[model samples]
Target: MNTKAEQTKGASAGDIGKLTLAAVILVAVIVAYTWLGNGNVPQPVRLIGLLVGLVVALAIGAFTGPGRRVRNYIAESQFEMRKVVWPTREETIKTTAIIIAVTIVLSLLLGLIDLILKSVILDWLLKLG
Candidate 1:
């Protein structure tokens, strides 16, 4: 019997192959659409090509067992992502303010040191001249 990890690996490989094939097919479709037309391809045909490619690619993932697993994996991942506890707007603003304040303070301190060093260097240069 195959372990869970092995099954997952096999499914991932199949998904990757399907995606690569889809990308190749999409590129071919785009090239034909562009070259076959006089100037730019019509908007409707382009949209139809995109929709067709999407449907075909998605079908590739649904028709096989590995494809079903890939779909399930995607759905589960989306569900898990929705459960994440994201930072609130207030927290984000507070973090941004703190970062800006620290940056300003450090910039002022560095500017003061740079001015003092420049004055000393100029004085030494004048004495040498």
Candidate 2:
């Protein structure tokens, strides 16, 4: 029995063509935006053209197989995210307090040891040279 999940089929020629069309639409949108921005086109008209171009590009992309797969992946990710067990406010506060306390204690201990070593090695031993 094949226990693995069925893999998605490879992209067909039609799917490749659809993806190429989507890319072309997006590129055209970018070119239009730049051309409009450089010219004396009105702001509202330019904005409308940009919006229309984006919608057309997205629509084309949505018709492609890869786009459908991407949408499915995003949906699955969101579903998995909803299953996470997030920490409560009280738990977070307690954890933060413990971390801060340990850090302070460790820093004090290390500082004291460093001071003792400096005094012994530099002050006392070096003075005998």
Which clashing pairs does model 1 show?
Answer: none
Number of the top lDDT candidate: 2
Across 17-41, the per-residue lDDT of candidate 2 in tens digits comes to 9888888988898898888898899
Which residues of candidate 2, in runs, are more than 4 Å off?
A: 1-4, 96-129
The TM-score measured for candidate 1 stands at 0.58
lDDT of 1 at 50: 69
Candidate 1 lDDT at 108 equals 100
Clashes of each: 0, 0
Off by over 4 Å in 1: 1-24, 37-41, 61-73, 116-129
Residue-level lDDT tens digits of model 1 in 1-129:
223563534445666777678768777777866775766668788778867877786676576666677677788788888989999999999999999999999999999999998988888876788
Estimate the overall C-alpha local distance difference test score of candidate 2: 0.88
